[model samples]
Target: MIKTKCFFCKKSYTIDYSDSQYQKIKANPKAYYVCKKCNESMQREAQSTTGLDMDVIDKYDKFLR
Candidate 1:
């Protein structure tokens, strides 16, 4: 596991070193990690503010993963 800090919350967390997301972050200096909690909160906020369908957001989120 690799130790890293969350981009939004600045909390420390661990991730698998070989994870694709870690590789992407390694390749891009500008890309920072967001912990799952922060990501979910942001997603919920976006859904509430934009009034977008949950299914649409879910589908897009899954596609990114």
Candidate 2:
């Protein structure tokens, strides 16, 4: 498992995966894994902040959250 800190919440979490899954996630520089609560909270916050549906934002942007 790799320990990662959430860019928004500043909380640390672990990612446990097989070698193939790890490689795939590692290949993507923008890959982020946040805890379930944070993910839900961020989505709601994004919608409220932008005054638009969550679909309008590009979830892949590392800096968006």
* Tens-digit lDDT track of model 1 for 1-65: 66778898999877776554687666664578888788889978988899996777466757654
Candidate 2, residues 1-65, lDDT tens digits: the string is: 67666666878766667432345456663576566577779878987888877554565654444
lDDT of 1: 0.75
After superposition of all CA atoms, the RMSD between model 2 and the true structure is: 7.0
The best candidate in terms of lDDT: 1
CA-lDDT, candidates in order: 0.75, 0.63
Please give the range of 10 consecutive residues that has the lowest summed lDDT in model 2: 18-27
Q: What overall lDDT, based on C-alpha atoms, would model 2 receive against the true structure?
A: 0.63
Candidate 1: regions farther than 4 A off: 17-20, 28-30, 57-65
Q: Which pairs of residues collide in model 1?
A: none
Best by TM-score: 1
